[model samples]
Target: MSKGPVLLTGSAGFIGFHTARRLLARGETVIGVDNLNSYYDPALKQARLERLQAEPGYIHHTLDLADRPGMTAVFAGHAPRRIVHLGAQAGVRYSLEHPESYVDSNVVGFLTVLEGARAVQAEHLVFASTSSAFGANGALPFSVRQGVAHPMTVYAATKIANEAMAHSYSHLFGFPSTGLRFFTVYGPWGRPDMALFKFTRAILEGRPIDVYGHGEMERDFTYVDDIVDGVIAALDRPAAADPDWDAAMPDPSTSGVAPWRILNLGAGRREQLMRYIAVLEEALGMKAELNLMPVQDGDVARTEADVTETRAALGYAPSTSIEVGVKRFVDWYRDFYGV
Candidate 1:
């Protein structure tokens, strides 16, 4: 069966770029959209867009999710079959500084996307959530079934709102929706604010790298390619209302009233912060000057995702080791920055 054109928001962002590229490679048409905001380096975002612009099956739109008229126009014009809504105000710490951006982008903007998806009757609307949504839970491995009412950061709070908003839209509009809670995703063309990117840059520049949580934190850092694969899989397979989903004993991950589901996309392996830095050092052949610090407010000590349901649903298996992934990221950094 021919997969119709995909309307992919955040096509200039890391995972979005990779997903669009993969879809294009598979001969699927993609209508890419991004506001090109200066959340990070806009130049980096532009460079990612440049790559996608080169592809034949791609059409680019410079627009924001909060711009209802703009977003609605795109949907009206393209009428995409599937929508991958990855655009949002990302960054946990930054949310501490600017909380309104999260509200505008993640909350209001997500509502706009949901409305558009409903209007167009999209086959599936797959959107990005975060592992940080597992805030204040003392659990070792976070699962979708766990209650995520206690969000540590405004960014996570916004994502939780997104999940609820999507569910409501699914129930009312009958469009399938899936929310992916991504772990620490890192790889080539990654976000500059992320730990791996910042660490790599500071180490290469002979500067001190901030080791939060006093080097005791751990993350289930999934590779970008693995995440992109899971996202595409979820997009292809629309969510279905679970027959076993009882209202008396509701599953947080599945829906009884609507075709809405949540899944964790992680490598299923937690690596320590110190060990991750070591792998980066090995890749760059340079040891970092670490400035150990207390765990920031809104920071979790550890995060590990239970991907059993993800594996069963999508046949997801993350194949990249930290060593290999870090090496690949370093290679890309050096080549891109001319270092």
Candidate 2:
């Protein structure tokens, strides 16, 4: 009568770490895997790993996803019943500077994770994708049902590729897979490279923070807790083939024949960049010195998530308001860094 252990990749990362923490707290076993590479700072990653290690139900596996032999061995050894693939070369701007990193981790590494699912016969495989996949769309709220083809950056392109790869795996191998197109996920123990963290850090230290798009950008800033809830819900119920799916007029969100689906996990409403900064300022009690600049390379002007399908399928509704979310995150930052 054992509820199967969930295999969580990128367990050292921000979102992955949060997901693992929540699962462990719920008395669920998580087989956490990560190479612990120096993407931002290995110290931060190591700290995350330490937190997971302290949890009773968490087991650690230090291995790169692209190391097929090592990854395969871990999967075969654990025989994980469920797979949550969150590891990838993140950061849209970073992708331009280091295209190879994106290829190695996002593309090659993703394929290895899929192979592990295939080998272990995981019941449900959920992978993390980005809202950036809807690049150059200029749509109000990015929808899962819409076709995403024009990705501006390599990172987005890779995610789009992942969706295609997962579909093939679902169709040919009969694996039930789900891809979460995450919006701007921010919270405590978050990525140092992310905007919220960067802005808070700079503002606290009295340094000028770069405000991209001349402070004209907006984002559907989904809290980490909300994103984690969506992830677990998606796993609890495996995606099924859309019974009414029409092959002639294919629905891009769900598969016609394969048990595959894509969901937008975000705070349905979008917020302006200035508004987010104001929230952070209030939480920190410090004003930021803005270094207004034109849109940086590989950066988007805005991002809005359409969570209608996600809400319908998994009863997903993100509850954390910006005020509460920002306050909590800043509180954690104060404690984390003793600020």
Name the candidate that leads on TM-score: 1
Q: In model 2, which range of ten residues has the least summed lDDT?
A: 1-10
- The C-alpha local distance difference test score for the whole of candidate 2 amounts to 0.91
Listed per model in order, the count of residue pairs whose N, CA or C atoms clash below 3 Å is 0, 0
Clashing pairs in 2: none
Q: Each candidate: what lDDT?
A: 0.94, 0.91
Point out where model 1 deviates above 4 Å.
Answer: none
RMSD of each: 0.8, 1.1
Which pairs of residues collide in candidate 1?
none
Best by lDDT: 1
The TM-score, computed over Cα atoms with residue i paired to residue i, of candidate 1 is 0.99
Writing each residue's lDDT as its tens digit, candidate 1 over 1-339 gives: 237789999999999999999999989999999999999999999999999999989999999899999998999999996999999999999999999999999998998899889898878999999999999998878999999999999999999999999999999989999999999999999999999999999998999999999999999999999999999999888999998999998999999999999999999989999999999999999989999999999999999999999999999998999999999999999999999
